[model samples]
Target: MNPREHIPVLLEESLALLDIGRDGIYIDGTLGLAGHAEEILKRNPRARLVGIDLDDRSIRKAQARLQPFEDRVDLYHADFKCIPELDIDFPAVRGILLDLGMSSYQLDTADRGFGHSQEGPLDMRMDDRNKLTAAKILDKYPEPKLAQLFREYGELKQAAKLARKIASVRRTQKIESTTHLRGLVEEVCHWIPQRGKIHPAAKVFQALRIEVNQELQGLGEFLIEAIGLVGPGTRLAVISFHSLEDRIVKHTLARLSRPEYGDSVIDILTKHPVVPSEDEVARNPRSRSAKLRAAVKRPHGS
Candidate 1:
């Protein structure tokens, strides 16, 4: 409901891998509401932070939340993909963190359209400057393309059936609201509420959100470039929510950890992803799906 209530998923696990005691900058690429950034500053007296997020609302809240550490922080209003272009002291960077999950604040805000549980329009744009929207995709995409999207992004079994359903509905009425589209998805998937079962509308909304924000497009490339930019021993931690994103992070880290030119660039800290414990998941249900993977750049010829 508020910034204070936002729990940074995999908080202690990420901080441990970061090894944040050194005197340098820590970059929170997906700052959200500065949940992790605040902790980093609070716990590591020597650490300064560079926090970046696409959501202006989150950034403003983060800025307010981080006011005490303003002198040690640099807040940016941009995408984490823009990390390579930012004016950062690469050599002095201690660690970098990217929590790829959508912030709770964004999901809680109805107008953002990140949550199917909430009734709102089909905006789904993390950055307001972005021209694409969930409604635009629904309105413009052909049935086949929509099917492909639902299948690939949402992994929905009834992709074609749902796409066909949307095609039928949009002819007479626009798919403008989150509730409107959610109801259609439920209808196509056959509405049934069962304990512990994820709603089909949640998958549909996730697929739309990914498409609207291009969430997966530049993620792997950014990780590779970022690892290449930082100095040896600089740590990187990523918390990805879905399998689509976790796959990218896993493969990218794997590739980087492999020896090339007689030297591996990074050492994968977690042979497998570090997931949240059942206790944390019980406390913050949104974090149940999170997977955290970390790596550190290796010194040359080692």
Candidate 2:
């Protein structure tokens, strides 16, 4: 697979929810490979964009793919949580999109270490600038702490057994690569063919990635800040891959839409999250788990 290739999940549905206008500013908070950004620019020729991504490699790829709209787009090498600090005035922004899934490029690239099916270094930092790595977490965390991480982040049923196995293995040799850790998980979890076809180590890898990047730590706060940045009637859409992220998006949007909450800032556009259709799933299997929820800001004081 080409490292630059990424099929933007739920592209048409997201565009419809965003309601892109003729000449307004839009923000793609997780601009991976410019897949969605390119389409947005194509649909609304005069629309300007603010693209943000933590991965420098992604930023570079986005820059190249979106070069045709260079004059209208501002690419930033920063976390989406820091959107409020971007010099742009929030009142003028028309739309905001947050896709909380890792891109195909990040996962397929062996060096980035996000996949369980391939061999790579146990380094899962989304931002290479970060000090922590999955290997470091395995080496430093105590058995109890490791168990908690797996249970809380991955929602794994055998977290304790997996943690104990890792602790015992690391004593004999350093857990330096993806294969080593995956082997440990398979040994402890004992994959059951009847349960599901999913790999036993999948959850463990996901848990480590979440911890290494602190992905869920400030998500709700970021959503609040993003909501504040849009003006009246402007929409915010988020695509979350896992239940942990989907829950956050669901509850935050629900809270802001309630009349009992101060001022009723938003109106939930989708009562239930929108999921990809069977055709979309067939075309891109990775998008099978994605769920998108959108809300539009209520007219001020209405």
Candidate 3:
């Protein structure tokens, strides 16, 4: 599948919250294919955008997709966590957006190894530059540490059992492919027969991917830094695909919204996350799990 065919999750809700100004400067922290960035620029032709992504493939695709707006868009091949360190000349950022879900391109590409249904090597690094891969994690991590990773990142109930299964199996043979790992998970945690039930190995795959990419490690730090880059009344919107990511965005915005948390830097705009409508979800099944949370920075004195 081409990057241009990828549909962004919660596009309308995020853009509504951003309230794009004609001459405003915005940052798309996870510029996967520039889907949302293109919409933003389309809505406000005079606005400028800074798009950042860790995946070189995404940067290349986004650059191509946004080529028409090259004069107004600056694409960077960097992690969103480095936003604060960026030396851009924008007077003040008017908005920031981070869609923390794996792009469809990443999941659909068999060699990228983000999906279990595909027969590929168990390499789920978001950035090809990252040395750690899911295969390496499974091969090297001990039973106890693997259990912890599954429990914390995946929230899997049978984490210990799955870890023990991997530990026993890996002693004689390495778990090098997505198929091998999926089989191990199915062996330990039998699949439920209920309709719409998620795959038995889904959570395990998520845990390994998170561990390999350190996706959750610097998330809070990045949110804080992104907030700092914007001025009072500027908005920030984050669309997270899973509960773990949504929880982080929810709590970070909450803390910033509270008066006790110093300047009350942010005022929560959505008390509950904005979910996609039935029509949108029908058109894009991948958007079903998305949760969008937005907040506006309070004026400095207020």
Candidate 4:
């Protein structure tokens, strides 16, 4: 599959909120396929981009897709949370973007072990460089800890029961593949009455991915650091697909944009989050869940 062709969700809404300036500098903290980065560059010839991602495949593909604008873009193989140390040459970045969803490539690759349907390794680390994998967590974590992970992160009502089943299954046979885990989850959840379109194992997989990547924890820190790095009039935009991530972005932006709590450094741009349009959702179902929040650095005394 051509990884470069992965469609970025809410593309128009994100770029619109960014309000790109011709000579400005920008950072795409979650540069998936450089879809948004490419558009940002096309909007302004003199604008420069610092694109970063934990996924090595994403970095390589983004580099190639953005190579036409070689002079204006720099790709990095790092997490957004570590943006403070990236080799940014620009004096003041005018815009920062965080698209916080796993890309189509990641979910579809199946070997990466993100999808519940695809039978592959139980590795869920966004950065393959990381040591921990889902299989390790399944095998090593105690029942209490696994239950806590499922309850808190997955919000599963039967967290304890599910954890017990996982522990029981792993003892008899190694839980080293996606299919193995999926079957285990299904066994425990087959009794749950269908009420909506969501799969029974969706939340479990989501929780594991978040835990594996330390996504929420890293996001909170990254937002604070990223907000402090931009200059006055700079814009920050975040697109979150899930409620957990959306909650973090929503609260962080609120605190930063507040005149009382904050240092009066930024102003909230999107009073309410901008969601994907109905047409966009129809075209791409994945875009349906996206919510975009934006804030701009306030001019001194404004």
Models 1 onward score TM values of 0.97, 0.96, 0.96, 0.94
Q: Which candidate comes out best when scored by TM-score?
A: 1
- Give the runs in model 2 whose Cα sits over 4 Å from its true position: 1-4, 192-196
Worst 10 residues of 3 by lDDT: 1-10
**Any residue pairs clashing in model 3, and if so which?**
none
- Model 1's TM-score against the true structure: 0.97
Off by over 4 Å in 1: 1-4, 261-264
Q: Compared with the true structure, what per-residue lDDT tens digits does model 2 show for residues 43-129?
A: 998899999999999999899988988999999999999998888767778889988868989998888888988999999988999
Which of candidates 1 and 4 is the stronger one according to lDDT? 1
Q: Can you give the lDDT of residue 113 in candidate 4?
A: 93
| Residue 292's lDDT in candidate 2 | 97
Clashes of 2: 0
Candidate 2 C-alpha error for residue 22, in Å: 4.2
- Among residues 3 or more apart in sequence or in different chains, the pairs in candidate 1 whose N, CA or C atoms overlap within 3 Å are none
What is the lDDT of every predicted structure here?
Answer: 0.91, 0.88, 0.87, 0.84
Candidate 4: where is the Cα deviation over 4 Å?
1-5, 191-196, 262-264
Clashes of 3: 0
- Name the lDDT of candidate 2: 0.88
Local accuracy of candidate 1 as per-residue lDDT tens digits, 205-243 = 889999999999989889988988888899999999999
Model 4, 163-272: lDDT tens digits are 99988988888898888888888888884547755775777888888888888886876787777766777888999988888998888887877777555467888889
Which ranges of candidate 3 are over 4 A from the true structure? 1-4
